[model samples]
Target: MSIAINLLPPEYRPRRHQLSRRVIIALVAGGLVLLAYVAFLGEMALAARRVAWLEGQLALYAPGAQQAAASNTALGDWRQKERELEQLVQNGRRWGQMLKTINEALPADAWLTGLEEDEGKGELTLTGGSTSLGGIGDFLTNLQGTNLWSMVSLQEVKGNGQSLTFTLRAVFPGAPGDAGKAGTIERAVEGK
Candidate 1:
């Protein structure tokens, strides 16, 4: 044991301290700053993981998204083709009916030598010979009476006294016209 004796006035005596209050406060503050920095680093790591997870999810769905887009485009194309096919079928039906009507309207004395049809223009040209001119006139009148023939014109008439050769050109109702004449015959036929 060591014994130290201070021989001084009571006011001049030195006091021994382990740590000052200011130093304790500064240490506590420094520890708190370090702890905060560690927490910030942890939070940044968590955010990075979350971002990586989200990117993986997006990548997983990317192929499915592309397939869905391609499916939509193919569906649209199929629908367009279906519409076009339906139109073609409808046109075929109309032409068949028109041909039947023309056959029915033909006169017994008249025989057709040539018949040509232009589907794009909806025009029909017929070259026929008839022993009687009256039969040709009757055929023309019968065609005109039908709503299917929008316009009928006599193209040529040439023959000897024995028989007559005539060429006739006619436009059907569904033909393209200034009046938008398509489907007129269909409507008229349905009405009848």
Candidate 2:
């Protein structure tokens, strides 16, 4: 059996070697809290690094992204202009052929006073006067037989004794190969 004895005075005595239960528990809790705080700081640092890296990558590709957007806009504009040009060319060709067919189909005693074309609607309106009703009928028949005209309608007819005034509207189908000869006449009219 071991026996310990203290020979010093009370003021010089050594303190107890064992800690209290509450002090030990408090120390353990403080250590756990410190560890959690350190872990949180490590996570924050890693997140900051990741964010900076992503921003750098985005910066590298930003110019190419802008260029691609501009190129797409330019391509769209070019396509729109191309479509408009095609529409204009189609209208010009159709008008040339339509005028030629109308000139050929008119009767000798029928003369056109006003002619109007709506390219967008594919419509042609003709206002004319004829010496006789038979002449107007012959002109209508001739127009109906032509390949250039469709949905030919005589809207109005006014008779003043020996003279007859008529209004007619027709739809022109944009045919493919019928514009060959009419193209020459168009060029002649344009003095080209």
Candidate 3:
């Protein structure tokens, strides 16, 4: 080992400048904190832009959506009316067929004066005059035998020794429930 001695005065001695471990660690930590803060600000800006874009899209489509909703309701109403009209047409056909059946069942000595219908009760009233009582019996029998009527019964009979006036009630199945109007058919008496 060799001993060395410095003879320089204190004022003339060189000074050494160096960083400590704690100071270096503090500088690195501060730099990392600043980077994280910058990243956070960038994310906030992006989120604000996304929110504005969504609002714009909503405003663009709102008017058309309202119009479509209104049209959908109108279409629904039109479809309902169409269905009701179709039902009425079907009922008309049924009524025509029933009248044709009655005409075909008439006897040569009997004639119909008037025909009335009660749709709700599904009843038909026939007023007519027959040349003889036997003619009325035959008419009732014919109406009863047909598949169209559920039941047939004589309501009244009046005879003056020359001709007979009769009222017959017949029950028809599957009548319409909605009340609109009653159908009436009238004919002049055979000779009057």
Maximum-lDDT candidate: 1
The candidate, 2 or 3, that scores higher on TM-score is 2
- The alpha-carbon lDDT assigned to residue 163 of candidate 3 equals 93
Model 2, C-alpha of 102: deviation from truth (Å): 1.0
Model 3 residue-pair collision total: 0
TM-score for all models, in order of appearance? 0.49, 0.62, 0.50
Worst 10 residues of 2 by lDDT: 183-192
| Model 2 stretches with alpha carbons more than 4 Å out | 1-14, 76-93, 116-123, 131-134, 159-164, 171-192
For model 2 the TM-score comes to 0.62
lDDT value, residue 117 of candidate 1: 81
lDDT of 2 by residue, 1-192 (tens): 999998899889987789989999999999999999999999999999999999999999999999999999999999999999998886565667778888899989999999987766767789999998787777777887887764566767898898989987776665332233333322332331
Per-residue alpha-carbon lDDT of candidate 3 for residues 71-102, written as tens digits (9 for 90 to 100): 99999999999999998887643767788888
Go through the candidates in order and give the clash count of each.
0, 0, 0
Q: Predict model 1's lDDT versus the native.
A: 0.79
lDDT of each: 0.79, 0.79, 0.79
